[model samples]
Each structure stands twice: as C-alpha cells, then as structure tokens.
Target chain A: MVRAEGLTFYYERLDEEGNVESKKRAVDHVDLHIRPGKFIAILGHNGSGKSTLAKHINAILTPAEGTLWVDGMDTKEEEKLWDIRQDAGMVFQNPDNQIIGTVVEEDVGFGPENLGVPTDEIWKRVEESLDAVGMLKYRHHSPNKLSGGQKQRVAIAGVMAMHPRCIVLDEPTAMLDPNGRKSVIQTAQRLNREEGITIILITHYMEEVVEADHVFVMDEGRVVMEGSPRQVFSQVEELKKLRLDVPQATLLAFELQKRGVRLPDGILRNEELVDELCRLKSKM
Target chain B: MSIKVKNVNYTYAEGTAYEIHALKDINLEIPDGQFIGLIGHTGSGKSTLVQHLNGLVKATSGRIYFNERDIYGENFSMKELRSKVGLVFQYPEHQLFEVDVLSDVCFGPRNLGCSQAEAEKKAREALHMVGLGAEYEKRSPFELSGGQKRRVAIAGVLAMEPQVLILDEPTAGLDPKGRDEILDQIESLQKERGITVVLVSHSMEDVARYVDRIIVMDHGEVRFDGTPKEVFRHYKELEKMGLAAPQMTYLMQGLREKGADVDADATTIEEAADAVEHWLKSK
Candidate 1:
C-alpha cells in the first residue's frame, strides 16, 4: 500500500544570477492512499500532475513540501529511495528510452542483475517476467528491432523482473495501438490478479479505465474526483468539463438518455448497450 | 500522384548476415487522392512498404511507378520524390533539435532550398494546419506538452507541402483528445488538400472507422486489401494473425450469432446504431 499527505512538488527555475527567479508547483496539496493489490486507473488531462504523483509512488521524485510512504517506508529518506523504487517499480511512457540492454532477455534481466540477485535466479525471473508480458517469444531478439507494443511489454517485463510489490505505469499504452493497449492492460491486470501486485495505471483512455476497480480523476494538480469507474463515468458532464471524455459507448448511451430513452448509466461496452436496448425492445 | 507497386520485393541488409525479408512480392496501386489505411501486427512489413512509396528505400526486386514514371527510373529525382511523398516517422520528435518550434518546423522546407522567409511562412501555415498557432513558434519544443510537441514535429513534415502524406502512427503516445485532434486534422487534410494519405496504424477500430481502404499484411506479405468491411470479414484469420476486428464489427457478428439480426459489416458506432435501429424497426 501507499500513502501521501499534502504532497507538493515545485519545479524551480533559476535566472542567470543563480537565484530562484520563480517556482511553479507541479503537484499541489495532494493526498492519496493506494491500497495493496488493487488495480487503479488515474485519469487526467495533460499537465494535471498525475505523472508527478506516479513518480512519488516509486520515490523517483521526492515530495518538496509534504510526505509520502510506500509500504510504510518513507520516500523522503535518502537510503529508502532504492528501497521505495524496488517496492514500487515505475514504467514510463517511452519504451525506447528505458530499454538499455541490446537483447530482449537481457533487458528484462537488467533490473534483477542491478539488484544483485543470484545469476541463476536472475534468468529465471527474467524468463518469468517476459512470459508474463507475452514477450518471451521475442526473448532472443533485439530490443531495437521490436515493435512499439513488444518493446513496451519488454519494459513491463523489466519492471516485473524487479519483483516490485506494486507497479506504477505512467501512460504505458499511450504509444501503443489498440491491440497493444489491450495486451498491456491485460498484462497489468494479470499481474495484479495472479501475482497479487498492486497496479497503478495512469492513462487518458476512458474505455481502458472502465475495467479498473477504482478510478481517480485529476485536474490542475489535484485529485479532483475519486471513485469506482461506474461512479466516475456516470457523471458525463463533469468529466467533459474537466477536458476528459467518457468511453464512446457510454457517451452514446448518455446522449441517447438525453433523447428520452431510459438507458442505464455508465454503459461501458457496446454489447452492454446493445443488450440493454434488446431488453427494452423485448418489453414492447 | 498515383503509385503503382508491382511485385515489390525488399529485404533489410540483404546479403548480410542480418538480412530480413521485410517485404515480399507485394503489388498494389494507390489511386490519386486515395486514403489508405495500412494495418498489421508487428513486423508485418508495413514500414517497408511505406518507404517504397517515396523512394526512401529501393526494392530489392520489382519496380515502383508514379503515374507511369519508374520511381527508381532516371528523370525522377529522389529529392523530388521525397518532396512529393512526405513521411512522418513514428517517433517524429526524435528528429527535432532546433532552438525553437518555428526553426524546427522550417527544417524540412529549408533543407529543400526554400528561402528563410518562405520556410518560416510555410512553417507557420503547417503549424496552423496541425492546429498549432503562431504563438507556439517562439516556445521551446521541450517545454510544450508531449501532444503539442508531436504536432510541431508533424508540422515540420507538413511544411514541405507534400502531395502524398504518409504518417506512421502519428497519434502514438497521445491522449484520447490528442488522438482525436490528430485524426480530425488528418481527415480534414485529406479532404481540403485532396492529398493522398497512407495512415499506418495498429488500431483496427480507428482504421475501420476512418479509412477508405484497408490493407492487411502478415509476415511480410499483403494478406488482404480492400474496403474495411472486406478486410474485417476475415475476422478469424486476422485474430489468428494477432489482430482484432473492430469492436462494432465484433459486436454485430456476435449479435447475429446470437440470432439478433445485426449487420456484421457495421464498423462504426453511427453505422451500427443506424443498422440496429433499422433492424429493430423492421422487427
């Protein structure tokens, strides 16, 4: 589990004189608690500080004015930075930037190797991790030659090899196609379900968010709304005002509701909407 | 310009130890001003085929013609071909290194020997085409949001005023709003400028919704090419190739199997809605 209290981050800009000319808070007065073993989706428009919040979960960016703890380890402690990162692995948006190893299997093993895991066990972890992300078939191939989706899966496998209790994926599917996106989401879910690792998926795709047990909506560097996906997406107007869109089916269903059709709220999938319409027609 | 590719065969690093038959005996014709959606799983030779369109890469065998002129044939300058077929690579931002957004966008036009002022004007217009404003010109590319930075990179290619624009996953690494904006801009560009468009994407739903024609590739060969409905009709085979049919198409197919009188060819939500409504009214 993770906890934050009044966390704030400032990006300090200095003039030529070496004095801080100004400071802009990227994350402002944010309080959060991520329960262990839950698949949570964080939704926000760009520059909403969601990425900043994700960084805090893994101690990538320590809080400037507040406190954060990962699994009871304070992130502010210098020695705990590595421990924090080990406890909650971070997967960034760009797979090309994170992958250092030339070969696929080697890339996945780099994390465990860096952690001083035994050589025999490192390969085992690497294989398991790659298999988890469906990248094992490409284990012998070069990372540079892989597709965006494959490379990202390798990145996830690299993080998985670290054996973190939780994985913080910052826009993991942003660069992927719909197939890649689905695979990545399914992998994250599998990790959460099978491996019992906590998952924090930060993305802007409303359809992907529908499957999450908990959803947090952020705007202007604050957690503006937090609830289940149905609870969050049911309020279509508020999401729209926040510059976010509901799932397409949900939006269409909402539009139909406004047109005097009594469809249910928070229709996540097209099948659900179709089924609802079919039932309505049966009554006639 | 129309492109006719006949039995094109290409291999990366051919004769070398790492030679990959990235493309094989592929033949296709891109009619003038046609909007083509190129879809495939990873390593399906989609990238290889696009490179041949603008002469970025020569086919190991076979010939490419642009309106009866051989692509590799004399009298067809590679520079002219490049200017005609503008390719925006997948990670376009990797190529940007100028001091400001304006300078970055002008890089392509300036390289083509346009005057500084002319390149700057082209940059401005290109930025506008991608929905960026003149105010973006002064800002540092790194300081802007990722989506904004991507638009600047796209504008750099658009500034060349290419007749045939090819985009490789232009909406990659963007949010939904950003994706919608980019797709809308591409759609408008195809309509307003009447430019030939080749959109390379992995999203079956997006391609099914927008593209006039869909080309499916598998293992470095053209597996299928036709309208979206025609390609998606082989839903089982596409799935076997690690691809998915569009959601609406899948839904309609499932409904028909469930005996719900839905049209399997309905690809978009609007079309599906209309089809379902019509079916319901008939019932």
Candidate 2:
C-alpha cells in the first residue's frame, strides 16, 4: 500500500529583483492512497506535479512536509532509501539515458548487480526480466542497434530485475513511437496482471489512461480529482478547462451527446460507445 | 522540388569494427508539395532516409535525384540543399543557443548568406508564422516553455526558406493541446506555403490524423506505403511488427470482431464515432 498525506514540496525561484522567492510549491498539501495490486494512472499537464508525485514513490525526492509511506516503510528514512527505490522501481522518460551496458542482457543485469545480487543470480534476473517484457530474444544484441520500444523494454527489464513491488513510469512513452508505446504499455499491464506488481503510470496521453484501473487528475500541484476511468472521463469539460483533454473516443462521445444521440455519460472506450449505440438502436 | 532515392544502401562506421546496416538498398520518391508521414521503430532507417533528402547523410551506394538533377555528385552544394530542405531535429528547441529569440531565429538564414536585414525580416516573419508575438522578440529562447521554444526553433529553420520542411517528432514532448496546436500550425504551413512536408513521427495516431500518406519502415525496409487508412487497415500485420493501430482503430476493430456493427476501419476517434452512429441508425 502507498499512502501520502498533506504532502507539500517547494523549489526556490528567483524574482525580478534578484531576491530569492519564498518558495514554489510543486506539490501542495496533497493526500492520496494507492491500494496494493491496482493499475493507477496519474494524469497532469506538464509541470503540474504528477512527476513530482512519481519521484516521491521511489523515494528519489522526499516530501518537504507531511509524510509518504510505501508498504508501511517511511520514505524519510535515509537508511531505507535504497530499499525504497528497489521496492518501487522507476522508469524515466528517456530510454537512452537509462540503459548503460553495451549488451542488452549485461545492461539489464546492471540494476540487480548494483543491488548486490550474485553474478549467477543477476543472469537469472536478467533472463526473467527480459522474458517479462518480451525482449529475451535480444539479450545478446547491442543496445545501440535496438529500436526505441526494444530499448525501452530493456529499460523496463532493468527495473524489473530489481524485483520491485511497484513500477513508476514517468511519461515513459513520451519519447517513444506508437509501436514502442504499445509494447511498453502491454508489458507494464502484463507485469501488473501476471506478476501482481502495482503500476503508477504518469502520462499526458489520454488513451494510455483508458485501460487503467484508477486515475488521479492534477492541476496546479494538487489532486483535484480521482476515480475510475469512466468517472474521470465523464467530466470532459472540467478536464478541458484544466488544460487536459479526453481521449478521442471520449470526446467524440461527448460530441455525440451534444448532438442529441442520447448516449449515457462516462463511456471510456469505443466499444462501450458502440455497444451503447447498438442498444439504443435496438430499443428504438 | 521532388526527391528520389534509388538503390540506397549505407552502414554506420562502415570500415570500423562497429558497423551497423543503417539502410538497405532502398528506393523511394517524395513528390513535390506532398505531406508524407514516415513511421518506424527506432533504427528502422526513417531518420536515415530523411537525412539523405537534405544531404545530411551520404548514401554509401546508389543515387539520389532532386527533380531531374542527381544530387549525390561530388560537387553537390550541401549548402543549397540545406536551403531547399530544412530538417527540424527532435527536441529542436534544445538546439537554441542564441541570447535572444530574434537572434536565434535569424542565425539560420544569416548563415545561409542572406543579408543581416533580410535574415532579420525573415526571422520575424517566421516567428509570426509559428504564432509568436512582437513582445517575444527580446526574450531569451531559454526562458520560453517547451512548446514555445520548439516553435521558435522551427521558426529558425523557416527563416532559411526551405522548399521542403522535414519535422522529426516535432510534437514529442507536448501535452495534448500543445500537440494539436503544433499539428494545426504545420497543416496550415503546408497549405499556405505549399512546401512539401516530410513528417517523421512514431505515433500512428498523429500520422493518421494529420498526414495524407504513410510509409512504414522496419529493419531498414519499407514494409508498407499507403494512405493512413490503408496502412492502419492491416491491423494484424501492424501488431505483429510491434506497432499499434491508433487507439480508436483498435477499439473499433475489437468491437467489430466481437460482432458489433462499428466500422473497423475508422482511423480517428471522430470518424469511428460517425461510423458507429451511422451503423446504429441503419440497424
């Protein structure tokens, strides 16, 4: 379980007069909780503090005020920082920046190696991680020659080898192509369903959020909304006013409703909208 | 102007021990005034292909023709090609190094040997083209937001007055609103300026929405070349290649497979909805 209560963070920004500003709160008095074994997607515009929240989960940055607890372990404890990071692995945006070793397998093993897993165990972890992401065939291949999705999978494998209970992906698909995005999402979903690991996906893409179990919407460094996919998407205009937009299917449904289609609210997927339309027709 | 690459083959670090077959014996033609979308997984030679258009990379074998003239000759004026075909690299904003936005935009045209006044004028015009106002002229490029800085970078390229503008993932890091703004601006430029556009993107959805034609690449080969609708219609092959149909396409197809009357070939969410409504009424 993950719990954050009244969390606040600040960064200093200088003013026009060259005097240091008091503080800029990247996240302010935010309270949130993620139950174990659920796919939670975090949606926010750029610089809206979703990434800040993500960094908190992996203990990369501790809260300046309030508290955060991951699996009942206090994030403020410096001694447990490494374990916290291992418990909640992070996959950053740039896949190129994450992968270090020359060979794919060797690079994946680097994470476990740093965690002090033995040489043989590192290989075992590497194989398993690669298999999880479906990149085991490219184990011996050089990373420089791999596609963006393949490279990202290798990055995920690096994180997976650590055997974290939760994976926090911060705009991981932003730098990838459509193909890369699909493979990465599928792998993350599989890991969540098959391995029972929790996924905290931070992204701007609306479509990516459609499959998520629960979602939190952020604006101006605070959690303004949280609900299932249907609940969040149902508030189309509210999201739009916050500089956030719905998936194309959701928007089209909203438009259809506007045109007096008599569709129900909170249709998240095209199939649901399709099924609803068919039902309306049958009833008519 | 048109660009034609015939039997092009290249390898990175060819003579050295670390060689990569970046491109195979490729043949393709980019017609004048056509908006072409290029898609590939990383290392699929899409970047390599665009680089050849503006003479950024030389083919190790075969020929490249610009209109009726062969451009791969030894005496090629890469300088001229740079003028005719402008390439906006990924995160083009990060390449902005000048102190002021105006100076930054002028750098490209000035380097191309335009008079200082001419370059400045073109720079201002280009800035306006990307929707920047007069007040933004004095601000540092570094001070701008990610989306604004990207437009500035594109303006810098526009100042060079290229016949074809090649954008590589121009909307990569943008939010939805920002992405639409950029894509809409690109579409307007293509229509108003009538410049051939080569859009290098990974998002099939973005390509499906904005571009007229699509080229799919894999392992240094052109796997599929067609209109966006035609390309996305092959859903199984696309998935097998580690690619995804646009979200709406996938959903529509999945529902169709499950015996729903939704048109599986809808390429956009809006189109998918229209197809559904039509089918519903007909039923």
Candidate 3:
C-alpha cells in the first residue's frame, strides 16, 4: 500500500555560480492513496509527471515538500530506506539497461542475493519467480537470446524474487510489440490476482489500462482525475483535452453516440461494442 | 530513386559458431514516392533488412540495386548512398549531441561537406517540416519534450535531403497525442517532398491506417507483402507469427462470427463505423 499527502517535487537548474537559476515543479501538491492487492494504472502525457510520481512510490525520489509512505514506512527516514525499498520494487522502461546477469536464472536470482537470501533459498525463489512469469523453461539460457517480451518478463521475475509487497512498473511495454505488450500486461494481472501482489502500472496505453481496478490520470504535475476505469474513460472529451485517449472501443462507442446511435459510454472492449451494435440492430 | 533487392542474403558473424542468418534470400522493389510499413515481431530481421537499404550491412550473397546501380559494385559512392537514403534508428534522440537544436539538425549536412550557411538553411527547412519553428533553433535539444526531441532528431536526418527515409519505431515511447503528432507530420512530409518513406513499427493500428503497403517479416524472411487490407485479411496467419491486425479488423471479424452482417475488411475505425451503420440501416 502507498499513501501520499500534498506530495511535491521540484527539479532545479543551477547556474555557473552554483546558484539556483530556475526551478521547475515536476510534481505539484499531489495527494494519493493506493490500497493493497489492487491493480492501479497511472496515465498521462509525456511531460505530465506520471513517471516522476512513480519514483515516489518506491522511495527512489523522496518528497521535496510533503510526505509519502510506502507500507506505512515514511520514505524520509534514512534508516527505513532499505525496509521501504524491500517493501516496494520498481521496474523501468528500457529492458537492456536494467538487466545485468547474462543467464536467465542468474538474473532473476540477483535481487534475492543482494537482499542476503540464503544460497538454497535464492534458487528456490528464482524458480518460483521465473515460473510465475512463465519463463521457467528458459532458466538455463542466456538472457541475450530472449526476445524483448521475454526479457521484460525475466525482469519482472527478478523483481518478484525480492518478495516485495508492491511492484511499480514504469512503461514496461513501451518498447514492445502488441503481442509482447499483451504478454507483459497479462503477467502483471496474474501477479495481482493470483499472488496478491500490488501492481502500479504507469503507461500511456489506453487499452492496457482498461483492465485496471482504478485509474489515475495526471497532467502538468497534478492528479487531474481519478476513478474506476469505466468512470474515467467515459469522460472522453475531458481525457482528450488533457491530450490522452480512451481505449479504441470506448472511442468508437463515443463517436457512434455523437452520430445519434444512442449507445452507452465506457465500452472498453471490442466484443462489448459489437454486442451493443447487434442488440441495437435486433431492436430495429 | 527506387530500391531493388535481388536474392539478398545477410548473415551476421558468418562462418563462426555465433553466425546468424539475419536475412534470407529476399526480393523486393520500393518505388519512389511510396509509403511503406514494415512489421515483424522482435528479432524477426526487420532491422537487419533495413540496414541493407542504406548500405550499413552488406549481404552475404545476392545484390541490392539503388536506382539501377549495384550498391556493392566498385565506384558506387557509399557516402552519397548514405545521404540519399537516411535511416533513423529507434530512440534517435540519444544521438543528438550538439548543444542546440539547430546545430544538431545541421550536423548531417555539415558532415556531408556543406557550408555552415547551407547546412543551417537546410536544417531550418527540415525543422520546419517536422513542425518546429525558429524559436526552437536556439533552445537546447535536451530541454524540449520527448516528442519535440524526436522531431529534432528526425530533422537531423532530413537535413541530408534524402530521397528515401526509414524510421524504426519513431513513436515508440511517445504518448498517444505525441505519437499522432509525429506520425501526422511524417505523413505530410512524405507527401510534400514526394520521398519514399519506410516506417518500421509494432502498432498494427498505426501501420494499417497510414501505410500504402505492408511488409511482414518472419524469421529472416519476407513472409507477406501487400496492401494493408491484404495483409490484415490473413490475420490468423499473422497471429501465429506473433503479430495481429488492427483492433477494428478484429472487431469486424467478431461481429461476423456473432451472426452480424458486417464487412471484415474494415481496417480503420471510420470504415468500421460506416459498415456498421449500413448494417443497422438494412436491419
């Protein structure tokens, strides 16, 4: 679980004389609360501070103004840093930069080994983690031989090996193809549903966010909107004004509604839209 | 100028244990003023095949002809070939090293031995084409937004005035709005300049909506090459190769399976809407 109050972060540019020439508030007075065992999605444009806010959840960036707590442990406490990080894990966008181990099994074991897990237990955790991500068959192979999607799943397995209560993924599917994207999202959902691990997925993909239990839309360093996926996606114009988009089916339904077809909003999936149209035809 | 590939075969680290047949015997022709979309799952040799277009990677066997001249033949100017066939790698914003946007864009022209004035003029034109203006010329390329930085990188290649432009996942990390903005600019620029454009991407929706032709690669081979409708018609085959058609196409297919009389050829949302409206009217 994660909670924040008036969370504010500033990025400063120093002049040649070491004085702060200009300061930009990357995250401005954002308040948020995330419950345990729930899948949450954060959507935003490029400079909307979604990634900046994600850093706060994992203690990667401490609050510059207000307070943030991960698992009830204040990130500001110096001694609690390790405990906070142990409670929450972070995955980044680039697959190549995060992976260090050459072999797949060894890579997944690095996190637990760093946490001082015992030799025998590290292998056990690695096997379980890789199996959770459906990569157990690739245990002995080099990670370099895997595809981008497979490499990302291995990254998630590495994070899982640490046994963190929450995992924060920052645009994990941005570098992948559609199939790869589906594989990564399904894995995350399975982690949340079956394993009860908390998931905070930060991405720009509208379709991927449709399956989330809660959706938070951020813009210009502020939490502009927050609700269930249906509640948020129904306001198509508001999201469009914020330079974001709803799922394709949702957009199509909205467009059809504008043409006087009298369809309901928040149609997240293709099957839902098709069924709606078929019902309308039957009524006619 | 058109590009012709004849029985091209490319092997990486050939004759070694680690050798990879990155491209198998491929034959294709790309005409001038055409827009192409290259789609493949990762490690499917799409990147390997594009590198051959600009002479970055030589073929292990077979030949590539650019405008009827063999690229591997003697007296063929690789330098000229590079300028005339610009290829922008994925995440090209990392390659912007110059302090300011204008200088960064001008680097390609300057490297080609153009004078400062000429390079600056071309860079200005290129930036303008990508929807930037004079205000961005003096600003640091690093300070711009992600979409703007990508546009600046594209301008860097555009300053060379290439006859053919190849972009590998140009909109990879951008948000929807930024992706649409960049793709729209590229589309208009291709039309305005009449240059051959090859876009390598993973988004079936984007490629289906914009490209004139679609080329599908699978395991170092050109599996299919045709119009977007033709390629997407075999959506099942594509799914087997870890690929898929646009969401609209799938929706239409689902409708037909559900006993609705919907046309399955709709690749875009507008076309799907029209088909659905027609069906509703008939009912």
**Maximum-TM-score candidate:** 3
Q: What is the TM-score of chain A alone in each candidate?
A: 0.97, 0.96, 0.98
lDDT of 3 by residue, B34-107 (tens): 99999999999999999999999989999999999999999999999999999999999999999999999999
The DockQ assigned to candidate 1 is 0.40
Candidate 3: list runs displaced more than 4 Å. none
Better of 2 and 3 by TM-score: 3
Each prediction's whole-model lDDT (CA):
0.87, 0.88, 0.93
Measured against the native two-chain assembly using Cα atoms, what DockQ does each of the candidate structures obtain, in the order listed?
0.40, 0.52, 0.80
Shift of residue B72 alpha carbon in model 2, Å: 2.2
Residue pairs in clash, model 1:
none
Q: Model 1, residue B1: what's the lDDT?
A: 53
Native contact fraction (fnat) of model 1: 0.29
DockQ for candidate 3: 0.80
Residues A167-275, model 3: lDDT tens digits? 9999999999878899999999999999999999999889899889999999999999999999999999999888888887887788778778989878899999988
Error of 2 at A251 (Å): 2.7
